[model samples]
Target: MTAHSRNTPQFYLTAPSPCPYLKGQFERKVFTHLVGDDAAQLNDLLTHGGFRRSQTIAYRPACETCRACVSVRVRVDAFEWTKAFRRNRALNADLVGLDRDATPNSEQYSLFRAYLDSRHSDGGMADMTVLDYATMVEDSHVRTRLVEYRRRGPDTAVNGRGAGPLYAVALVDHLSDGLSLVYSFYEPEHRDRGLGTHVILDHVQRARALGLPYLYLGYWVEGSAKMDYKRRFRPQEHLGPAGWELKDG
Candidate 1:
């Protein structure tokens, strides 16, 4: 069935839970299961409507009193790299990212674990096991890719794949209008390289190369220091009551 077929999507609200991004706040979500033949199309519509996907689920914040979680996307055609962003890209010039089908790897899990331990020890996904990682990457029905970033090695000229340990990895979805960054993590020790920022920059380039208009960056929680980096990608659009509008940083 197509996304507009008679089978209508059913959305549900989650019970109150402690807000992950902001303290002293409770968070709720309106979510639906993305499945069947129309999963990809449904995903596209939901995403454009301000929902985000996790595995086979699409969800968006539906808090009772707070609207802190604002959906953000980078406007690819209008994106211009600032001096700081250019420096971030230059800092990781030795690394290359290889796009692979959404599949789980032990090495990716190892780096994921290290990243969780080092950066988000008390966060929601800190205790995720290898199986969970596998499901996160492989359980999707929509177009998804796991891009692994690594340092250039001896065989770099022969094959495009980078050699040595993994420096960073991003779980991304290819949507009709843009690429959606589902989740990403990098080697904690390499924080100086600003790999997180580089990953977004790379995706912006990828979207531009693909002729996509936007690169979805998921929710940007206002006042959350952890989400401050997202605002750096200027010429972005924030989905609000009036719909997506340009927010020039």
Candidate 2:
């Protein structure tokens, strides 16, 4: 293929599928390949424009009759530090999250399996194998990383790396504007520790430290209880027809 064609992304559409967030509704997605040398820049632009990247593809809901999926991003500087957020951080205080490369291993897959079994057994990725997990972590053309949350090891202070088996993992995309949490999972047995909430808290702090403005959290369906957690992070922006608009409460 010519360089010009490779550089210019081509968009496509998917066949209608049952909407995962809303009942009795169908969902369609408009997507394009996030490949070539300009992948990172393309990803950043698309994400800001309400697209989400999954490996080499960037897509968003294109449902003809539904406009429920709204793209969300947390304002790092103005995020609310409510009592519950502090409580969740204290609950998982003993753990440390070390940013690592976008490589997947057996341990992460094991945790991913347990998480799916406990929470998403009926979900789309319920039957993923180890190799599938690897592809999900490594097939990206744009920037990505894995933040592994683990128990603080003896030498944690010196090396900035955590210790022991992985308690939780977050697949992140490093964008020019901020960090995008592609996906995250934790040890099913440690649900009470609030690993998921802690991870978001950690990311929020990280972005603020880096002087980034927003922490992209993908789409939030207004009526979906499954996505209600995204609402807790205050001072966020929801992508609307005009553009990114601030949301209070």
**Which portions of model 1 show Cα errors greater than 4 Å?**
1-6
Best by lDDT: 2
Q: What is the lDDT of candidate 1?
A: 0.93
C-alpha lDDT (0 to 100) for residue 63 of candidate 1: 99
Q: What C-alpha lDDT do the candidate models reach, one value each?
A: 0.93, 0.94
TM-score of 1: 0.96
- What is the lDDT, from 0 to 100, of the residue 148 in candidate 1? 95
Candidate 1 backbone collisions, by pair: none
Clashes per candidate, residues 3 or more apart or on different chains = 0, 0
Against the hidden reference, what TM-scores do the models get? Answer: 0.96, 0.97
Q: In model 2, what is the error at residue 37, expressed in angstroms?
A: 0.4
* Model 2 stretches astray by more than 4 angstroms: 1-4
